[model samples]
Target chain A: MKKQLQSLKRIGFTVGMTAALAASSLAQAEDKLKVGLMLPATGTFAALGTAITNGFKQYVAESGGKLGGREIEYFVVDDESDPAKATENANKLVKRDHVDVLVGTVHSGVALAMAKVAKESNTLFIVPNAGADELTGPLCSPNIFRTSFTNWQPGYAMGQVAAAKKAKNVVTLTWKYAAGLQSVDGFKEAFEKAGGKVVKEMTLPFPNVEFQAYLTEIASIKPDAVYVFFAGAGATKFVKDYVAAGLNKTIPLYAPGFLTDGTLEAMGDAGQGLLTTLHYADGIKNAKNDAFRLNYAKTYKSQPDVYAVQGYDAAQLLAAGLKAVNGDFSKRAEMVKAMEAAKIDSPRGAFTLSKAHNPVQDFYLRKSEGRDNKVLEISAKALADPARGCKM
Target chain B: MDFYSFLIQVLNSVQYGLLLFLVASGLTLVFGIMGIINLAHGAFYMVGAYMAFALSSLTGNLFTAILLGIPLSLVFGAFLEWALFSHLYKRDHLEQVLLTYGLILIFEELRSLLVDDEVHGVAIPDVFSASIALNDTLSYPVYRLVISAVCIVLAIGLYFLIQRTRLGMMIRAGSHDRDMVQSLGININLIYRTVFALGVTLAAFAGMLAAPISSVFPGMGGGVLIISFVIVVIGGIGSVWGALFAALLVGFADTFGKVLLPDFAGAIVYVLMAAVLLWRPEGIFKKG
Candidate 1:
């Protein structure tokens, strides 16, 4: 017992010393262009952030560790997918290290908070994964650019798909948050615009584990199709429960992209044939996408998702912006102009700036399937473009 | 509510309550009987989940993983009891809390190092993947029913072990007067070890079961740990049956609260705990 206490004490001392030394060393490196990547590095969203970081790092590596001929330095902080932590990390990046740009925020709620800090500091905020509509809508700012789709675009496209399939009655199940509600609202707008009735709209909270009761209610509604917007374990549990409710035979179930990959991995065979929409898919057969997929698979030993692809694009966009400015990053106006005029080729396709300063790219329809007892994308192809209902 | 909806809610409540019992039983025994306030009970739960995740992945069998995990958890609990908890048994609540509070950091950091920070999940068996039909329209996965049944059996076994057995009487007596049992020439240290091991095993078992339902990520146990403390408080400290009753009550309230009032569901549990404490300072059930 005495030996154990002594060992614990020694471990604590070593850890404390190591942390102190790392902090001091970090303080001395001042000339480099520091970019802070803030996301959930240690929580339920860790894998998502990790993949995004991998994408960011891949771009850096491919660029010979230099962006616009300047050696780049990256600082990644774990936000734990908490809004308060996002705000804290953003402040640290903006005020402490004085990072050249901030690229991150996976949760919509956290992204919204970080947007406020970006507005205050006038730093380039390149959001890659968070799908809150307000990031490019009402919350749109001169310094902010979203490389990912909003909660609206995918849901609206889903509505169009439902309309084409001639699904009359629809039931929408979403997490009761900004991102979740926006997803349902987007689908509702697109579906109703195409003359369809929304039978039920269920708003569940984030991190909800069980869905048996809600499934019972939705099954009773007997809608033609069920549109869901859940992420993480919630998505996995929902898919399992959807199958348990036997809704797949009675009513078709559809969701956005995030519901399929990590969630599907968790759900395993239960998630087979689950359809979702996105801008990028691992199964896309394009030259650029295939190359990116091959490179990502070779490097990470896992297929890259849209979030990772967007994060890579974000790094590339920053590089393009820096190049456009003739590498003169001292002037915000010059950099902003360069960023605005920049066009880049993405895994999705060639993306250019919209009036809102967000990306205008193609969307894909994907279905989850198991090939040879391992989960893989079965169907993936461009289906729609982000347009209408936004004058920004 | 419709019959199908009502039945599902009942199932949700039962499953949740059973999970709470698993954590609270360990906690209440340590606190009520031993008079030690442990904030690190949740950390053990976290350890259990991560252990199950790693072991199950390695062995490719849940039963083997559980067999290995429970002993590891017991050893961990015993180590904690010897290195930290036993020292504070004679000390006041403040010191016990401060020491156990430090244990939380130790446990969390250790778990983080051992298990990479990722939002992964434990896979359920193939047979349990399908739902059992309660009726024509209402059905749930067989895994959940299995979880409920396992919890109930464990709860019954624990009740019998603690109440009916000779060892149970000694533990009950030790809870009240540790030195008195020591004076009677009983190996009080061995008794302490047994009780501590039993407490931790319950928490780890809960973690193993819950791993499939939720994302088995870092810091996952913190949330459940706090709720279990609430269960221990609401049920009455050191009372195993009280822990069981309170676990179910809290579970039902939390599940139904979420469905009926989504916003206040989490807040309502703490509110109920405070209200119950106000009504009966010790808890809903007193230690007999």
Candidate 2:
């Protein structure tokens, strides 16, 4: 009887300890916010990914590594800018890591895959860089949001700039792909409406840098201006080749900011005076932008571009939502409502989200000067995506 | 298109074709004489382009960069052969493919570590930077013409070296019967090593010459590699002459296809490859 009583006392002690541990762990879980970052850590888009990650972390750091009284825990996965692996990589973060929110991706194709997974799982997702229109148009969810402009935004703004320049006949060139085609479509929609003609729409296979044939044809067509959509290494090569072929001297080149952003340094004198449109530029003289740029350069040893701006705004949007709920994820409806209504004071300037969850922001006319896309003027004010296929 | 535009397109085709030849010739020579399918040949081209970018930045002249880069590439090629590829010779094709493919990954990773993945421009030598005006708006960069001239010169020199020299005789003989050449007291291994290094040097030199126009970037080799393989296969694998012919044919097809059928341009070269394969299973030339 004495031994039996001792065994019961031991069992009671174990039960009490287990209850205490469980209660503490539950409290800890509620106090932490899990953020999954699925970005390209390798391949062509790696540098852009790094800049975005830096910008996100920079904001969190400024807030003392906490958002809305909750400590932030980050899980990172490199999507490799490959769409084939994007679903699996996102699932690793969502299903396995059980992250509360997902932030990602520069490549449009990979972004689409991540959006599908996020939609299916009903996880909160914020796109920082990819400008795929479908993300906000057809595939948008109440849980999904974008801090960056749609692919159409900058392209449409540039078309207005080109038409205002009185370019009667314009040629559009890009690699044949969804991003390229959509950008061209955006350019056509705005330019043609403004009484300009797209004389030719030329495209090569995706990732093909050989532009001699196309350039030769462009010269023959003799359009008043040439608008192109190319980014990264392809952009640098095109700018240099365009200058080398003497087309830049006779026929001016117009493009969205992607043609000049992150590519000006490699373009040398070839990129001088090249005009493009974007949501952010180096010469935006606002106090918030100044502080953000100063802090980003000091912390990362690189100047923040539009991509970094988008990432920073993504964090700001999330912080606003989290602040509304005091880190209570169970109050998700109220939190999401707070996010939709919040005006993000971004480095690009103050912007609000459209009904489709895409940023309604200003697009700036920027010129490539040395290593900077110096802001010339505001090209468009508070531009919003049409969200053509969005039902919600 | 008008006559002048067509004339310019022809010039573009030829220039592109000649550049492709410089890269494809090396592939053919390595395969013909060594019986080794070098998947990493394109990586050597990338190395050359990067060297041009680095050396030109240091020296401030692309001509000087190429002058310095050639010997460095020769040494690199020789060292790589002696260290890793020499062992690969006795292995089967699968083993060779695996090893060379691994080399490509290693080279790309090393490039990323050494020089971050950013596009870099190599300035054309000042003398070759000017454009030759063909019409009011159409002008051709002189650097491209210079590239065609240099490639033609190299091709002639390569022909003389392989067809007219004693070393060339030993190389051709060794390719045919390695054991017989060894029995005849010739250092067949040395011949193979020299041939391999020469092939590497040619590819690297082409890369250096093209860098000013192409702009050096990562994965640049991947595109060139596929085309080089096509050239080698279409040119009858081992024949340098055949590679030259195939490269030009592909260049014309690609250039014109882009002009005529913009939507189908990417498929045109592969279609040409298929047609050629159907016509001549051994390629345009028999294995030498």
Candidate 3:
């Protein structure tokens, strides 16, 4: 028994020494700025995550394969849209790889976890896509920067558009979660202010696609318009069911940008004439979008959507920050300040960062046009998210 | 809700329950007769949807795609039975679950490789695309009604096949005593394979039929798979009638819950399952 214990202790010591040696060797071998991506590699947000990666890579390549003349290396961990496993995945990149800047995440729940980890470690965090309002609201931090729209920004714009169209009674529907609640709250804030009555509010548990009962209820309620907040497969199913139930003819449907993005390709003709609000849209009549879209298609063999644009802008923000610090990164405060101050000539529009680090950008009022978005109106230009409940 | 709208909600519940019944029927049959927990059952459903998507694009007809897809599903199911599931028959339930789960992973990966994991909608045949006006303000979809009718006919056919046929007698007997049936000189192995293959075919058909309404996407099968298992457990395992009744009970509970109790809609299905488990640990129906 004594001999066995000694051998076990010796084995444990050798294993620990080997791990330390390997980690040290890895650090000695790489002299590049480490960028870690923790994004959903599969499930509901996989395509968005892929687009973000592609967009980021496209920006890096355009900047001569370096950000501010510093070579950047990447490590990726799949968040899988699972909030429970999110901290572990982010920590693997933050502590193990010791990445200088962590870019992530499409699901808001997972993003919340990533933001928490970034806050604890003081790691520079650039959000590529998730849009829970709390990220910029009460949970806002100096080290956390978002290149995406808040859940409120687009929803608020949709409310303004609905009010302008003379909608008196509207029904709001969404899943029950941070993103869904914030979206409805934002819409309600603007719609009620515009003298519209929210007749009824309905929500399903998050990630559940059973919308039949709700569809029947909507028909009975007979609202002037339905303001829905759903994305990915849920969005696809809702649009189809809505049309099938013949509610689309009598009542108009409005949603935030995510309801239509890549989902239009799947929804086909059912998606036509649907009005949504977002920061980015296709056919924006700008040289920046032209180049971004063309090169994105040429490289990835698919047209880039709003998610890709957010991803490209994330790299753009990082590049701007690096340029400000002359790539030294040790001046952490200055790096963040530079990032906050930088003006981005994005595919969406010319935009700058807000005090809370979320984008202050134009919201495009877009109509779905044959598997693409045609910009109809600019709902709010250089619009800053209210980011209510934020102490920062 | 008004009476007319309540009626519409009832239709919705029935339609949802019928879809569940189609998938759960196969799951219960395979579990009852073969005594194997097939987690890859959902993968077969996904395969059917993908098959319809692929063949519809090729043939330019949804009905024709489904017809061609059925044989392919049967062949694939039979191949699975021969290559992998056959060995798992006598193994422990954990081994069966693990092997089937592994199959689900492989199936998902292959689907991703082929279809790029994006949502794709199937067009409902134009003939069934019209709606029945419920009142001046509302209407019910014709395709949903047609789906329900077809499911009813299929249910009747399944009932007749099981209760009034030689094959069903052997299946029922095998469910009760596999070793005894084998000892009685019936090729019980052949019956198990047939039952397994038929179960796969039923699930695949449900997927094909549901494609137009649900919109096929990656990870689409996971939710239905979980729900189907709940149904199988709450209904007696291997009892088709039990699955049908339990599915309807779940469907009504879920539909009513969503309309009446929106916050707890997702939990209501499981709540019903738990209540049933508490009352009858073996399930709502007794084993044959």
- The model with the greatest DockQ is 3
Q: Which pairs clash inside model 2?
A: none
Which whole-number lDDT from 0 to 100 does residue B134 have in model 3?
77
Pitting candidate 2 against candidate 3, the one with the higher lDDT is: 2
Can you tell me which runs of candidate 3 are displaced by over 4 Å?
A: A1-31
Looking at candidate 1 chain A, the ten consecutive residues that score lowest on lDDT are A371-380
lDDT of 1 by residue, B19-90 (tens): 678778888877787777878788778778788888999999777899999888889788877776777767
The CAPRI category of model 3 is: medium
Q: Higher-DockQ candidate among 2 and 3?
A: 3
User: What TM value does chain B of candidate 2 have?
Assistant: 0.98
The 10-residue segment with the lowest total lDDT in model 2 chain B? B154-163
What is the TM-score (0 to 1) of chain A in model 3?
Answer: 0.93
Q: Candidate 3, residues B49-161: lDDT per residue as tens digits?
A: 88888888899888999999988888888888988998987789999999999988998999999888788988888889898887766677899888888888888888788
What is the C-alpha lDDT profile of model 3 across A1-392, one tens digit per residue? 99999999999999999999998978773667899999888876788889999999999999999998789899999999999999999999999989999999898888999999999999999998889888888889999999998989988888899999999999999998878888998899899999998999899997888788888888888999999998888899999888877889899999998899888977877899999999988789889999999999999998898889999999999999999988888899999899999998888887999999999999999999988888998997788898887887
Indicate the worst ten consecutive residues by lDDT in candidate 3 chain B.
B132-141
